[model samples]
Target chain A: MSGVKKPVERRLRGEAVPALDVARIRADFPILDQQVYGKPLVYLDNAATTQKPRAVIDAVTRYYEHDNSNVHRGVHALSQRATEEYEGVREKVRAFLNARSVRELVFVRGATEAINLVAATFGRMRVREGGEILLTEMEHHSNIVPWQLLAEQTGAVLKVVPITDSGELVMEEFERLLGPRTRLVAVAHLSNALGTINPVRRIIGLAHAQGVPVLLDGAQAAPHIRVDVQDLDCDFYAFSGHKLYGPTGIGVLYGKEKWLEDMPPYQGGGEMIRQVSFKRSTYSDIPAKFEAGTPNIAGAIGLGAAIDYVQAIGLDAIAAHEHSVLEYALAAAEEVPGMRVVGCARAKASILSFVLERIHPHDIGTILDRQGLAVRVGHHCAMPVMEHYCLPATARASFAVYNTREEVDVLMAGIRKVREVFGQ
Target chain B: MNDLRDLYQEVIFDHNRNPRNCYCMKGANRTAEGFNPLCGDRLTLYLKVEDGKIAEASFQGSGCAISTASASLMTEALKGKSLEEAERLFQAFHGRITRDTGGAAPVDLGKLEVLSGVSEFPTRVKCATLAWHTLNAALEDKGEPVTSE
Candidate 1:
């Protein structure tokens, strides 16, 4: 009986690296194969930005080489090719998110810009004076500041749902905060500083029950887990391509078709407009209405290739491999004296945010960097989460599909070196 | 390894472990706050100036070994020094940590020379210089917190 369930047991025990060939996956990212400070580089900063795969790089290069032209409004062959490739990426992102239609996805500069787009258009329309925009304590600054700007403009109040000591959102607080005055609920799908996988589905359900629309800040979540906008029923969802192994300066804002039809154009320019007059000007449809000028054509095409790459390998396999590596890192951290892992959510992704007793995270970062280990050491643009934990900063070592247990071991050794250097 | 050791020398660890004059002054006339929002290093510098010379210097805050040690050693060095001399010392300290030296004679910073290793690690130079910038603010009575953005 034990032998029969061996494979299943191995997975449960977090020995599931065999789900995907990490060694072969690592080879796809050329930047991972290098040295820093005479030591082999162990990149653990995926939460900041991921290294691009050859597929993504080749896609961007191919766009520049073959089909470099202004998209739309051009009668040339290259223009048609460019426009098709750019529009094809929108379809790819639409299918990736399992949205109802390609009309839902609007490409912006990144998740930050996506949130700002919603705040400028949807938020300005729905939120009124004295109405509240509810958010959680664990949101990144990008999620918070945009709404703050909106509140400042419209006299709307910002209500916060508190989190537990374990970094999980207090559902009771969220329920209490969700009231008649709530206009929109914007929260992180996954906390970047703590790696907490928030109960966004339940949050969405609670908000929808109150007839309040919800927008998910999926900057950290989209790259790790499978996101279905239709299943979650979130009014809007935002994520960055750079964090998802695609090019920078490009992201997606997935909005429902009904809402997209109602909201005004985020920016006014050439492509977003249908007809312009001296007195009156009309705008384009859902996506083109949001996309104002010539967009990041190569970036969107690269994101398309990125979607193809991840889909070929499968997100489930990637998630399983990262889970095992995170578990191994957590276990290995036990041996390091004074080591404290900050986020202890039962459901989490692959980020390991921690702090050493009496040792500043910047020092830890510098020492680890000397050993060719790259980890983010700061508030991670989530200062409110740091304030919730009563910490100034944390040293974070985040994992990705290409990360390995062996790299985690190197990180452990580097952490030990940090303590030794500090004479702890 | 060598560069890391150079940057994080024994004196820096000593100063970090036992930061001197790490307390808010009760009767201070000149004061300034230093903040590095990126790394979350923050400190309040207090100076008791009498007759163009520093009578007492103290600070209280939290930072990494580099910034904490620089502040600690700075308070110790500023005691009984003339205002002009302190200005010279700040310039010398800043120059030492930022310039290449290029086989030229090193600036005479006394105990503060321990931080000269910060030149090898470009990112930590701001850590080493944050306190001195705050000192300049204190001297000028800037009335606003100094930020190393």
Candidate 2:
């Protein structure tokens, strides 16, 4: 009972306005100081892409300046240095993911490409014509479209797990969807559009119990929550660097070693092959089999630096701070007349998607932008979710560690302006 | 909020609140659904064509003020015009909204010309033009190609 009380106290205190050193964090991101439309920028689009910190930018610059050479093949000193730095990122990613081996970590262009790799290599190898692929209705287009393409190519049936009105996944229905024919379960660890932190660990366990593999799309979760692939025991996990306060055009895919070894190569090129001949070419092992061409060397190094930055701040601290911001924004947003907060899931990240009555989301975004407040307006690439809610689109204000309660107040005022302008 | 006045002109908000011609024709010759997934704007365009003339036009859907009002304005602009005239109007409206050239000279879009301000907000231009895109799609069977920017 005493332990339970401690958790409850923390949860209650978590809702209180966080004492975030906003000045210090804002100093790290130089982009926050600029003026948009003669107003100081208030960026609330962290879910779309996070702004890069000074450390990440410096890391990228340093990579190009000092370690500018080809990786793995060059014999020169610069090449060796570059190769070590490049491979060192893989090791850092392995630790970040809590993966068993560096061999399990494969770098791709982004989450979309990572999922496509899995769908092409793993899906083609393991999934048969009549096999079933389980997905949820709340998935982003990245998570849904790749599997749909695979299903179309392989003649597999795609089964969708329904979502409740609150945007939580229907676990009972998901269980019913799983059967002997289930070959793979692809799901997002968090819904980018709704801010729902899904029960992926339980979902993975259920899939494994049925002897089916699971792929977790960690694009939205990696930056906000503590993720341990070993603890979750998921077969594959994918995430993008841009969403995690790192550089764009870089992502990582972590697969179980056994599965990685079993799947065939996704792309064919110079680095992915062990030995090449005119007649037959043998592919390299695990990660190299997937990373076929000249990779984003500077991007990878920047991502490694980004991981270091997150580690310095601590994920628990970030999560707690963001949770407080989300709670405050949610409560304050409800105070505005004609404002309805969309995606009211019990377990959510720091995303507030909403609509003002009689006002379109684009109108809300435009009005907010005039106030120097930046928010995303539209379906957010989750069209099915929009269709589900019967909304044309929602205005979303997503927060990161750099955001402050004052910014949330600005967002609230923007909503009031929207109500006033729309005469609601 | 310096130009908050410019962002929400009274005309824009009025059209948004009480959009005209915002309904479906019961026996329209053609209808097409258009969606801008990014902004969650969904529109269904219904047209009544009689003898190569757009006898009636209406739009039914849910979207932000820019899109809904734009749809309402589009229907009003196209009604009672010959198919060729409607196509030319659609082109002029597209250019006016997107800030492109080669529209029907300077002064074609009378009341619809207020939407020329939308070109300044690059993102909302898509919202303003979604209805017109759906209209073009519905008007395809009239055997005239309608181009939208």
Candidate 3:
């Protein structure tokens, strides 16, 4: 469990990494195999961004080294190869999300851009004066702000579904919030600040029953669990590549074909144009219609490689191991006097958001980082959740496929040091 | 990790846990709110100025050890000093913590010199300066909330 010289490469197609072999899995992320402050690095910030596997880094390097060219417009060999690889990733993402067709998958910069795209187009199309857009208090700013912008423009009111003291959403309150004026409902599939896995499927069902479309922000969910957009029946889904062990500047926005067709193009540019004139410019069909620019070609290929890496490891194994680690982390952190775990949803992923008595989360983060344990602090870009608890901020430690119990112990020790510094 | 010791000295921890003047001053004439939104450190500094001198300085807020300690020490340093003298000490103290040593000292920071270690932790510079900026705001009668971005 201490040292793994190499990652396990040869395996049955769907064979999961054994729980005891997390060290071997950790070896694949080269960035994890390092020291900080002369101590072994303990990275617990997976929710913010997961470190890339060798496969993803190699894929990006391979793309740049061998086939570096722009896609969709080139007739040359390099251009054609680049286009194929870039487009190939679209199909891979389609399969990863289990979307109905490649036409449903639109590649954008990241979840932020994807949501903004939908808010600018689908939101503008549907939301109207005095109409409502429903959201939850657990939403990240990315999910909240874009809708706020659209509401400001269209005079649409933004209604928030409150969360319980335990950080879980109030189902009855959600039912109450769902009304005739609700034009759209956007919420997080998994809370990035809290580890609560929302009942998006049921939420989607409720919204669709009211003839209102739903968008699930899967930026935090895509990395942790298996998500099938078709099975969930969400009208739209958004997720980032960086959080899924892929490179930055690439993400996916999955919208139903009908909505994608009805909504105007988010941004007009060369690739998304059917025909271009000063008077009127018709748009391309489906996914291409939403994706306007040249796009993150290398980032798309790298994301494909990341998806392959996760599929090979098996998400079931990842989930089981992460759940155990989170349990251990929660218990260990709670043992410290005055320690309070912020999110206590019965159903949660692998995030431990907590605060020690009289210690600022940023100070805790700084001390933990000194011990080479990276944890996220502050509001986790979900200020509404913090406001709900009347807390200024929280310290968060999130686990991933490659994290081990040993790393969790290191984090616990670092937290103890924080307690000592505060003299608690 | 050894350098962290320099950043979180015993003096800082003691002051952080039991900050001096850690409340709103009664009959305070000048007051301003300071916020470091990135790290969620927020403080309100109150100054009682009499004859252009700070008769009292107090604060109320929540922040990291460095920030709480800095604000605590800043209140101690600012009390009984004239407005111009307080501003001069602010410059010297700011220079010491920020490692901008080129500025000549108008007044010795004394106990505030413990914060000299903060310069090494570039991210913490804002934490140490939040109080001073708020004091600056209070002195100028600027009611706008001071933000150390």
Best by TM-score: 1
TM-score of chain A of each: 0.97, 0.96, 0.95
The lDDT of model 2 is 0.86
Across A1-424, the per-residue lDDT of candidate 1 in tens digits comes to 2332344447656644346877899999999999999899999999999999999999999999999999988999999999999999988998899999999999999999999999999999999999999999999999999999999999999999998999999999999989999999999999999999999999999999999999999999988888989999999999999999999999999999999999999988989999999999999988899999999999999999999998888776777777778877877887789999999898888899999998999999999999999999999998888888888899999999999988998999899889998987
Error of 1 at A180 (Å): 0.3
- Encode model 3's per-residue lDDT on B5-122: one tens digit a residue: 8988889988998999998778999999999877788999988999998999999998888899999999998889999999888878878877785856445678887888899888
C-alpha RMSD between model 3 and the true structure:
4.2
Model 2 error, position A285 (Å): 1.7
Off by over 4 Å in 2: A1-9, A12-20, B1-4, B30-33, B142-149
Query: TM-scores, in order shown?
Result: 0.97, 0.93, 0.95
Task: Give per-residue lDDT, candidate 2, residue A72.
Answer: 86
Query: Which parts of model 3 have CA positions greater than 4 angstroms off?
Result: A1-20, B102-107
> B43-96 in candidate 2: lDDT tens per residue?
788889999988898888887778877888888888899888877777888887
What's model 1's lDDT at A243? 92
User: Order of all candidates by TM-score, from best down to worst?
Assistant: 1, 3, 2
Model 1 docking tier (incorrect/acceptable/medium/high): high
